[model samples]
Target: MSIAEKLSQMGVTLPDAPAPAANYVPSVRSGDLLFVSGQVSSGADGLIKGRLGADMSVEDGAAAARACAISLLAQVRAACDGDIDRLDRVVKLTGFVNCTPEFGDMPAVVNGASDFLVEVLGEAGRHSRSAVGANLPFGVAVEIEGIFRLR
Candidate 1:
């Protein structure tokens, strides 16, 4: 099945690709690769804001990370000129989690994005990743940037 069909089966409808929050564009293409800017955690309800190891639990942070992944896909779609299937595979993801200084579960929190992508895109979704704890902008729980190889 196509990526659209897969997303539908998973009960997700990609939101409109978000505009850049600063001078930088949301995505840039070089050669066959698309590099997407960081997508902050957000959903229909609005930004998922909190600091893990402080007010947010691991599960909640994971959910926020998943929202970032959705936004990443939306950006990817826009980069492909609305044809997400042109994406060959996810190349890498760098995830940032807002958390207390001692927080040690960053990898598990970022797993939210990793697992969701794998579920939707299967093997193509698998990619190298880095998850780290940081004080993110706007107090959002997560932010993720991605690199995709286009078909």
Candidate 2:
């Protein structure tokens, strides 16, 4: 089935692609690769704001990362002219988690996005990834960026 159909089977409804919060394009294509800008943890309820290991739990941070992933996919869909199936493979993901200096579970937190992508796209979703703790913009719990190979 197509990627869009897969998303539907997973009960995911992509939100409208969000406008860039700064003077940057949401996604850019170069040759056969597409790079997506960092996407914060945002949804209909608004940004998921908190610092892990301080006020939030690892599970909550993971959820925030998952939300960021969803936003990233929305940008990717837009870059493909509203068709996510144009994506051939996920190349890499860089995830940043807002957390206290002592927080050391960044990898687990980012697994939320990684696992979701694998569930949705199967083998094409497996990719190199980095999960790091950092002070994120707007005090959001998580931010994620992606690189994809286009069909």
Q: TM-score, each model?
A: 0.98, 0.98
Candidate 2: which stretches are off by over 4 Å? none
Where is model 1 poorest over a 10-residue stretch in terms of lDDT?
Answer: 79-88
Among the numbered candidates, top TM-score falls to 1
lDDT digits (tens) for residues 46-90 of candidate 1: 889999999999999999999999999999999888998898899
Residue 117 accuracy (lDDT) in model 1: 95
Off by over 4 Å in 1: none
lDDT tens string, model 2, 1-151? 8989999988999999889999999998999999999999987899999999999999998899889889989999999889889989999999999999999999999998999889888999999999999999899999999999999
> CA RMSD for every model?
0.6, 0.7
Q: List the residue pairs that clash in candidate 1.
A: none
RMSD of candidate 2 to the truth, in angstroms, is 0.7
TM-score of 2: 0.98
